[model samples]
Target: MPHLVILYTPNLEAQADMGRLCRSLADTMLAQRDDGGAQVFPTGGTRVLAFAAAHYAVADDSDDHAFVYLNLRMAAGRADAVKKRIGDALTACAKVHFEPLLAQRHVGITLQIDEAPGQVYDGKIGNLHALFAAAR
Candidate 1:
Protein backbone atom coordinates (compact mmCIF):
# COMPACT_ATOMS: atom_id res chain seq x y z
CA MET A 1 0.00 0.00 0.00
CA PRO A 2 1.26 3.44 -0.92
CA HIS A 3 -0.49 6.53 0.31
CA LEU A 4 0.88 9.89 -0.70
CA VAL A 5 -0.09 12.72 1.59
CA ILE A 6 0.50 16.34 0.61
CA LEU A 7 0.51 19.21 3.09
CA TYR A 8 0.89 22.74 1.82
CA THR A 9 0.39 26.29 2.92
CA PRO A 10 -3.11 27.65 2.32
CA ASN A 11 -1.69 30.67 0.55
CA LEU A 12 -0.48 28.54 -2.33
CA GLU A 13 -3.89 26.98 -2.91
CA ALA A 14 -5.06 29.91 -5.01
CA GLN A 15 -1.86 30.08 -7.04
CA ALA A 16 -1.54 26.34 -7.53
CA ASP A 17 -3.99 23.60 -8.42
CA MET A 18 -3.82 21.10 -5.59
CA GLY A 19 -6.23 18.68 -7.24
CA ARG A 20 -4.19 18.55 -10.41
CA LEU A 21 -0.98 18.15 -8.45
CA CYS A 22 -2.51 15.21 -6.60
CA ARG A 23 -3.40 13.49 -9.83
CA SER A 24 0.01 14.19 -11.28
CA LEU A 25 1.77 12.74 -8.24
CA ALA A 26 -0.53 9.73 -8.29
CA ASP A 27 0.38 9.15 -11.89
CA THR A 28 4.04 9.43 -11.01
CA MET A 29 3.60 6.80 -8.30
CA LEU A 30 1.79 4.49 -10.72
CA ALA A 31 4.64 4.82 -13.17
CA GLN A 32 7.27 3.33 -10.88
CA ARG A 33 8.45 -0.17 -11.85
CA ASP A 34 10.71 -2.77 -10.31
CA ASP A 35 13.90 -4.20 -11.77
CA GLY A 36 11.89 -6.90 -13.52
CA GLY A 37 9.63 -4.24 -14.96
CA ALA A 38 6.69 -5.11 -12.72
CA GLN A 39 4.62 -2.31 -11.24
CA VAL A 40 6.19 -1.38 -7.89
CA PHE A 41 2.85 -0.21 -6.52
CA PRO A 42 -0.54 -1.83 -6.95
CA THR A 43 -2.86 0.28 -9.05
CA GLY A 44 -5.75 0.19 -6.63
CA GLY A 45 -3.60 0.41 -3.52
CA THR A 46 -2.33 3.84 -4.54
CA ARG A 47 -3.92 6.86 -2.92
CA VAL A 48 -3.10 10.58 -2.97
CA LEU A 49 -4.46 13.00 -0.42
CA ALA A 50 -3.84 16.74 -0.09
CA PHE A 51 -4.54 19.01 2.85
CA ALA A 52 -4.07 22.76 3.01
CA ALA A 53 -2.97 23.93 6.41
CA ALA A 54 -5.43 26.49 7.77
CA HIS A 55 -2.76 28.02 10.00
CA TYR A 56 0.99 27.77 9.83
CA ALA A 57 4.35 29.55 10.09
CA VAL A 58 7.20 29.22 7.68
CA ALA A 59 10.80 30.50 7.88
CA ASP A 60 10.82 33.52 10.22
CA ASP A 61 7.01 33.56 10.36
CA SER A 62 6.81 35.42 7.10
CA ASP A 63 3.48 35.09 5.30
CA ASP A 64 5.33 35.57 2.00
CA HIS A 65 7.01 32.18 2.47
CA ALA A 66 5.12 29.03 1.62
CA PHE A 67 5.87 25.30 1.82
CA VAL A 68 4.70 21.99 0.42
CA TYR A 69 5.57 18.71 2.03
CA LEU A 70 4.85 15.30 0.54
CA ASN A 71 4.98 12.13 2.54
CA LEU A 72 4.77 8.75 0.80
CA ARG A 73 4.11 5.74 2.96
CA MET A 74 4.41 2.26 1.52
CA ALA A 75 4.91 -1.34 2.54
CA ALA A 76 8.53 -2.35 3.04
CA GLY A 77 10.46 -4.76 0.77
CA ARG A 78 11.64 -2.59 -2.06
CA ALA A 79 15.29 -1.84 -2.73
CA ASP A 80 16.76 1.51 -1.72
CA ALA A 81 17.24 2.27 -5.40
CA VAL A 82 13.57 1.76 -6.04
CA LYS A 83 12.58 4.13 -3.30
CA LYS A 84 15.02 6.75 -4.52
CA ARG A 85 13.61 6.48 -8.01
CA ILE A 86 10.11 7.00 -6.72
CA GLY A 87 11.15 9.98 -4.64
CA ASP A 88 13.06 11.54 -7.50
CA ALA A 89 10.16 11.08 -9.89
CA LEU A 90 7.68 12.56 -7.48
CA THR A 91 9.96 15.48 -6.67
CA ALA A 92 10.53 16.24 -10.31
CA CYS A 93 6.82 16.20 -11.01
CA ALA A 94 6.22 18.51 -8.10
CA LYS A 95 8.98 20.88 -9.11
CA VAL A 96 7.50 21.22 -12.55
CA HIS A 97 4.08 21.82 -11.08
CA PHE A 98 5.30 24.51 -8.72
CA GLU A 99 7.58 26.28 -11.16
CA PRO A 100 5.24 29.19 -11.59
CA LEU A 101 4.59 29.61 -7.90
CA LEU A 102 8.28 29.27 -7.12
CA ALA A 103 9.08 32.16 -9.43
CA GLN A 104 6.35 34.28 -7.90
CA ARG A 105 7.09 33.67 -4.24
CA HIS A 106 9.51 32.17 -1.76
CA VAL A 107 8.59 28.55 -1.20
CA GLY A 108 10.14 25.28 -0.11
CA ILE A 109 9.19 21.84 -1.45
CA THR A 110 10.13 18.61 0.23
CA LEU A 111 9.29 14.94 -0.34
CA GLN A 112 10.00 12.00 1.92
CA ILE A 113 9.38 8.28 1.47
CA ASP A 114 8.68 6.11 4.49
CA GLU A 115 8.68 2.35 4.31
CA ALA A 116 6.52 0.44 6.75
CA PRO A 117 8.44 -2.43 8.26
CA GLY A 118 7.12 -5.37 10.29
CA GLN A 119 7.42 -3.33 13.45
CA VAL A 120 4.80 -0.95 12.12
CA TYR A 121 1.19 -2.00 12.52
CA ASP A 122 -0.99 -1.26 9.53
CA GLY A 123 -4.70 -2.03 9.43
CA LYS A 124 -6.85 -1.70 6.39
CA ILE A 125 -10.05 -2.87 4.75
CA GLY A 126 -11.14 -1.95 1.27
CA ASN A 127 -12.81 -3.23 -1.93
CA LEU A 128 -10.97 -0.87 -4.23
CA HIS A 129 -8.24 -3.38 -5.01
CA ALA A 130 -10.82 -5.98 -6.01
CA LEU A 131 -12.52 -3.53 -8.30
CA PHE A 132 -9.25 -2.73 -10.05
CA ALA A 133 -8.44 -6.43 -10.44
CA ALA A 134 -11.85 -7.09 -11.90
CA ALA A 135 -11.45 -4.32 -14.43
CA ARG A 136 -8.22 -5.90 -15.63
Candidate 2:
Protein backbone atom coordinates (compact mmCIF):
# COMPACT_ATOMS: atom_id res chain seq x y z
CA MET A 1 0.00 0.00 0.00
CA PRO A 2 1.30 3.42 -0.96
CA HIS A 3 -0.58 6.44 0.31
CA LEU A 4 0.84 9.86 -0.44
CA VAL A 5 -0.39 12.58 1.84
CA ILE A 6 0.22 16.24 1.03
CA LEU A 7 -0.12 18.95 3.64
CA TYR A 8 0.37 22.52 2.61
CA THR A 9 -0.03 25.94 4.08
CA PRO A 10 -3.37 27.62 3.49
CA ASN A 11 -1.88 30.76 1.99
CA LEU A 12 -0.91 28.92 -1.21
CA GLU A 13 -4.39 27.53 -1.74
CA ALA A 14 -5.39 30.27 -4.14
CA GLN A 15 -2.17 30.09 -6.13
CA ALA A 16 -1.79 26.33 -6.25
CA ASP A 17 -3.91 23.86 -8.16
CA MET A 18 -3.80 21.03 -5.65
CA GLY A 19 -6.04 18.75 -7.67
CA ARG A 20 -3.69 18.86 -10.61
CA LEU A 21 -0.74 18.32 -8.33
CA CYS A 22 -2.41 15.27 -6.83
CA ARG A 23 -3.03 13.71 -10.21
CA SER A 24 0.51 14.47 -11.28
CA LEU A 25 1.89 12.88 -8.15
CA ALA A 26 -0.32 9.83 -8.54
CA ASP A 27 0.86 9.46 -12.10
CA THR A 28 4.44 9.77 -10.92
CA MET A 29 3.88 6.99 -8.41
CA LEU A 30 2.39 4.78 -11.10
CA ALA A 31 5.44 5.33 -13.26
CA GLN A 32 7.92 4.05 -10.67
CA ARG A 33 9.58 0.73 -11.47
CA ASP A 34 11.93 -1.58 -9.63
CA ASP A 35 15.32 -2.69 -10.91
CA GLY A 36 13.66 -5.76 -12.39
CA GLY A 37 11.40 -3.38 -14.41
CA ALA A 38 8.28 -4.37 -12.45
CA GLN A 39 5.97 -1.71 -11.09
CA VAL A 40 7.04 -0.47 -7.68
CA PHE A 41 3.52 0.18 -6.48
CA PRO A 42 0.27 -1.59 -7.21
CA THR A 43 -2.08 0.47 -9.34
CA GLY A 44 -5.10 0.12 -7.09
CA GLY A 45 -3.13 0.55 -3.92
CA THR A 46 -1.95 4.02 -4.83
CA ARG A 47 -3.73 6.91 -3.11
CA VAL A 48 -3.05 10.62 -2.83
CA LEU A 49 -4.66 12.84 -0.25
CA ALA A 50 -4.15 16.58 0.10
CA PHE A 51 -5.08 18.90 2.94
CA ALA A 52 -4.68 22.62 3.42
CA ALA A 53 -3.69 23.37 6.96
CA ALA A 54 -6.16 25.81 8.48
CA HIS A 55 -3.72 26.68 11.27
CA TYR A 56 0.05 26.55 11.18
CA ALA A 57 3.26 28.50 11.65
CA VAL A 58 6.25 28.54 9.39
CA ALA A 59 9.72 30.07 9.86
CA ASP A 60 9.38 33.37 11.76
CA ASP A 61 5.61 32.91 11.76
CA SER A 62 5.25 34.96 8.63
CA ASP A 63 2.16 34.66 6.48
CA ASP A 64 4.28 35.23 3.40
CA HIS A 65 6.05 31.94 3.98
CA ALA A 66 4.41 28.67 2.91
CA PHE A 67 5.25 24.99 3.16
CA VAL A 68 4.25 21.75 1.49
CA TYR A 69 5.01 18.48 3.23
CA LEU A 70 4.58 15.22 1.36
CA ASN A 71 4.71 11.93 3.16
CA LEU A 72 4.65 8.60 1.31
CA ARG A 73 3.79 5.54 3.33
CA MET A 74 4.36 2.09 1.88
CA ALA A 75 5.21 -1.45 2.81
CA ALA A 76 8.77 -2.09 4.01
CA GLY A 77 10.64 -4.37 1.63
CA ARG A 78 12.39 -2.35 -1.03
CA ALA A 79 16.01 -1.69 -1.81
CA ASP A 80 17.45 1.66 -0.75
CA ALA A 81 18.02 2.58 -4.38
CA VAL A 82 14.41 1.84 -5.27
CA LYS A 83 13.17 4.00 -2.43
CA LYS A 84 15.49 6.83 -3.43
CA ARG A 85 14.25 6.63 -7.00
CA ILE A 86 10.64 6.82 -5.88
CA GLY A 87 11.41 9.78 -3.65
CA ASP A 88 13.33 11.55 -6.40
CA ALA A 89 10.52 11.08 -8.92
CA LEU A 90 7.91 12.41 -6.50
CA THR A 91 10.05 15.36 -5.38
CA ALA A 92 10.75 16.30 -8.96
CA CYS A 93 7.06 16.21 -9.81
CA ALA A 94 6.19 18.43 -6.87
CA LYS A 95 8.99 20.85 -7.65
CA VAL A 96 7.75 21.30 -11.19
CA HIS A 97 4.16 21.67 -10.06
CA PHE A 98 5.11 24.43 -7.64
CA GLU A 99 7.63 26.17 -9.84
CA PRO A 100 5.39 29.12 -10.56
CA LEU A 101 4.53 29.63 -6.93
CA LEU A 102 8.15 29.29 -5.91
CA ALA A 103 9.17 32.09 -8.25
CA GLN A 104 6.56 34.47 -6.90
CA ARG A 105 6.59 33.54 -3.24
CA HIS A 106 8.61 31.96 -0.49
CA VAL A 107 7.75 28.28 -0.15
CA GLY A 108 9.29 25.15 1.23
CA ILE A 109 8.51 21.72 -0.22
CA THR A 110 9.60 18.44 1.35
CA LEU A 111 9.05 14.77 0.52
CA GLN A 112 9.64 11.85 2.86
CA ILE A 113 9.06 8.11 2.48
CA ASP A 114 8.13 6.08 5.53
CA GLU A 115 8.09 2.32 6.00
CA ALA A 116 8.02 0.30 9.20
CA PRO A 117 9.58 -3.11 9.57
CA GLY A 118 6.13 -4.47 10.34
CA GLN A 119 3.00 -2.58 11.14
CA VAL A 120 1.53 -3.37 14.53
CA TYR A 121 -2.03 -3.49 13.24
CA ASP A 122 -2.65 -2.87 9.58
CA GLY A 123 -6.05 -3.66 8.13
CA LYS A 124 -7.39 -2.84 4.71
CA ILE A 125 -10.58 -4.01 2.99
CA GLY A 126 -11.44 -2.81 -0.48
CA ASN A 127 -12.39 -3.99 -3.95
CA LEU A 128 -10.20 -1.43 -5.72
CA HIS A 129 -7.42 -3.96 -6.26
CA ALA A 130 -9.78 -6.33 -8.07
CA LEU A 131 -10.94 -3.52 -10.30
CA PHE A 132 -7.38 -2.75 -11.37
CA ALA A 133 -6.58 -6.42 -11.88
CA ALA A 134 -9.65 -6.86 -14.06
CA ALA A 135 -8.51 -4.01 -16.27
CA ARG A 136 -5.27 -5.86 -16.91
- Top of the candidates by lDDT: 2
TM-score of 1: 0.95
User: Cα miss at 125, model 1 (Å)?
Assistant: 1.5
lDDT (tens digit, per residue) of candidate 1 on 1-136: 7999999999887888999999999999999999989999999999999999988999996788999999999998999899889989999999999998888899999898987787556677989899989998
Mind giving the per-residue lDDT tens digits that candidate 2 earns over 1-136? Answer: 8999999998988999999999999999999999999999999999999999989999995789999999999999999999999999999999899998899999999899999677899888999999999999
Residue runs of model 2 more than 4 Å from their true location after superposition:
none
> In candidate 1, how many Å is residue 36 off?
0.3
Among all windows of ten consecutive residues in candidate 1, which has the lowest summed lDDT? Answer: 115-124
Q: lDDT values of the candidates?
A: 0.92, 0.95
RMSD of each: 1.1, 0.8
Clashes in predicted model 1: 0
